[model samples]
Target chain A: MSQAACIVGIGETDFCRKPGSGMSQLALQLRAATAAIQDAGLTPRVIDGIMPFPNLGRAEQFAANLGCENLRFAATIHTGGAAPVASLQAAATAVNAGMATHVLLPAGWNGYSGARVRQTVSQDVASIPGGAIARDYYLPFGFTAPPQWYSVMARRHMYEFGTTPEQLGTIAVTMRKHAQLNPKAVMHGRSMTLDDYLASPMLADPYRFFDCCLETDGAAAVVVTSAERARDLAAKPIQIMSGACGQPYPADEITNRKDFFRTGLSIAAPEAFGKAGIGPSDVDFAMIYDCFTFELLQQLEEAGFCKRGEGGHFVEGGRIELGGELPVNTHGGLLSEAHVLGMSHITEAVRQLRGEAEGRQVEGAEIGVVTGWGDFGDGSIAILRR
Target chain B: MSEYTKPLPELEGHTKDFYGFCKQGELHFQRCSACGTWRHVPRELCAECGSWDWEWARSSGRGEVYTWTVVGRALHPAFQQSCPYAPTVIELEEGVRLLSEVLDVAPEALEIGMPVEVVFEAVTDEITLPKFKRVAAS
Candidate 1:
């Protein structure tokens, strides 16, 4: 357990689902990184470390281009949606150990509609060393796509708790409603009805087009340093009070696990909460990862926001709205916002802390919890406050 | 049912129709004889105890439908013809759960904890996916 590292600055390329923006992934990542540095009011020359999400920048060359001389902190992480919080945790550890003064965590992707729709696997995507032994068993069954893999949960929830399609659509619609207020949200003002949801096409059954997220091309980055030193910087301090990364105990995929009702995410949320000395109810806002609609609900239940099987009712009561008990995905979300490579939720948390969010702003928001998207049994959590 | 067929995804691993029973309208679970635990992906070794002693056995394929989602729209080129289908997860009677399609049942008829049984669906010439149908209430 290391000391808390502060997130002093955050920046992002505009969120859009369009192609032919004429920006390579490297350039887009640089735009976000440089903006993060400037947002922290620090010179790029001061940054000595960088942790980019997979496919964003070309490793060492990216650092060289950023003019980071003698870069001491550098690495890349995969597991798709979980990269944001995990990379931030890496940066925080580096800051705590005095490995680097300023750290940059950037992510980018440029395949929405231009060259191809989107690739489900990276050239380097692989099975984990120890526990990922189920590729032989499940891959042959068409349980490949990460979202479709999550469909196991969706089905189980319906069987165990009577969860319905409309209940899942409620999550999507809520995220879209919030996106309508966020200028950077791709689906902003682009409303989707439940009928449109039910009538849409299916990917793996039980998951329709609207039930899944879009593939967008963009980038985002955040700056981290000592919370004490962050006060001296020109940017407002967004404290990274608690952070953690964990995975399912030696399992292949979610379906192969013992408990289908509770996921490993539940294992992560409490650890971050204990580190932050705050409970789920104490937080004023949440920036949960939503690669698929049912997962968000499943995560909510696992994170202790509500009891098991209670999420359907909790969300249906408008508890997830901007003016509700605790507004979730205020900057929209992966569901309605731009689905960058990863870390979109972290960037949204930064915006919420800075109070720069236009229409999706929660009134007087002072606390927030952000999560990472990891499948392959990996997950991470972060607790932040203004 | 329409005569038109939808192309299914090609999965690599087993050379023979190892999972063919699921397509033959039956649920099969793999048992690690050395460790005494059930596995989803048919394997040669015990995933938990690392024992190579294993065999594929028939399961009741009768369990509660744990969770499911009703996809609102078509997502893939292969799925365009099958919009608005209920992809379900059925927890088999053997304490193992598998992702499966709930067929011949209307969307409104789906209920959590409802009893279901396995049915064979020939997705491709060499592939048969195990689908589920709700047990009719007496």
Candidate 2:
């Protein structure tokens, strides 16, 4: 078996903000998996491995529904939003180890319809990420949601580095602008300006409404196989050059971290870029996990796109816009695009590499990076090449 | 006071003593005897030294505001009444940080590195939360 792996195919269901799709989570997962398999020019029986997102569904059920005859490898990633990007590493490892020829990674959730973060906090303490710390420490003070939890870091960043709300607004405006080009984006038709972003109601301190990612109901899947096998595949294979996952100390809790500003991407990014034998400058674009605007800025710094405390300036002056130095979130990202748990980031990267992104395509894009931020600060990065 | 409608801490085996100390009007954190490191959200073993031998060391109940967020909109149904409350992260003098709210301070008044002292709020008969208040400058 060859050591190299490539993403052979990608697929996703329509991104929605409500449960009106009339499809169960499992049905959505299978639909995406089927589309991905078909896009690879392979039947369901040929898919030998599965990497299912935790809590979405089980591998066995996915295999049974997809009609896989011989399911060789099966595993689930538990790093929250980071799971999708990290699954590329797992799939690459499995394929390179001769354990599986083709691995299907599927991620989807009823984020808006089924269990919103507000509702999930009250459901079961065990189900929530950092459940113990959240129930005991955060909830009692009414710090229940992602916006509240992440706002602490955002405020600290501003205090330490003088990151203004306008810098954050630029990100929200840029993403919404990109969304206008992407019909699949949840906020495609809705344009936003920096003034509008500043005018948006504040959800938490240092974080306005536009700073938050859409609570999307969606699913996306990708097929990974050895680069050697990819030659015989139908789709233009996007090489999975390097993938890495990292967790900050005390990954579950946020308040106790030694350097509250440092995130898991700080550790994962260098390792991934090094493994790929490249630096941040070599990439043509980036599909950064934009769970929040501040997070996107933080990841850019941590991912080595710019120096620490310089992310605000790095994103300024249309540097991250389309046709800029490094186009980011060409599919509008989680902020304007539907939040598919960062799986959409992966698919968008593939589309860009394959030159399939119609209006948002970066001209002659060869290298692209995608990142995922999950739980408190767990991060994953995958460097892809054409 | 009216009934405490918000979510309360689930007293696990490891966390019960920490809450118990709060109920007694004291703030305590698990300190590793070997490494002399303090930890919060009480855990069984030391994260730094991996030692199970630890003690519930009393805190001076004084800390500084490490960071905070004024939730403009309540994510929880109960907090809707208390819209725009600041949930603060306080770094204690002992060098451990915990999540709590700074009482009697406006959201704009809260500053990073502002001195604060712990205050126990008995929300329910069984649960006592350790919150914070600004320390007046001498």
Per-candidate TM-scores read: 0.82, 0.97
lDDT of 2 by residue, A55-75 (tens): 789999998988898999999
**Candidate 2 chain A weakest ten by summed lDDT:** A118-127
User: Model 1 Cα displacement at B76 (Å)?
Assistant: 5.4
RMSD of each: 4.6, 1.5
Candidate 1, overall lDDT?
Answer: 0.72
lDDT of 1 by residue, A1-386 (tens): 23468888888888776544478778888888888889999887778788877555555876788888767888776655677787787788788888987888888767574444323331112532222333433332333355666776677677678889899989988988888888778887688777778887676556777877777777888889986678689987888888887777443546556765555576788888988888999988888888889878887887889888988887887899999997888877888887775577887887788887766777788888888766554677888888
| Cα lDDT listed for each candidate | 0.72, 0.90
Output the lDDT of residue B49, model 2. 89
> Candidate 2: what lDDT?
0.90
lDDT of 1 at A303: 81
- For each candidate, the DockQ is 0.27, 0.82
Predicted candidate 1 versus true structure: per-residue lDDT over B1-138, tens digit per residue: 454344343454441444566556666677888776877655667768989887777787677776665543433344445656655667787888776767877755777777888877775666676777778642
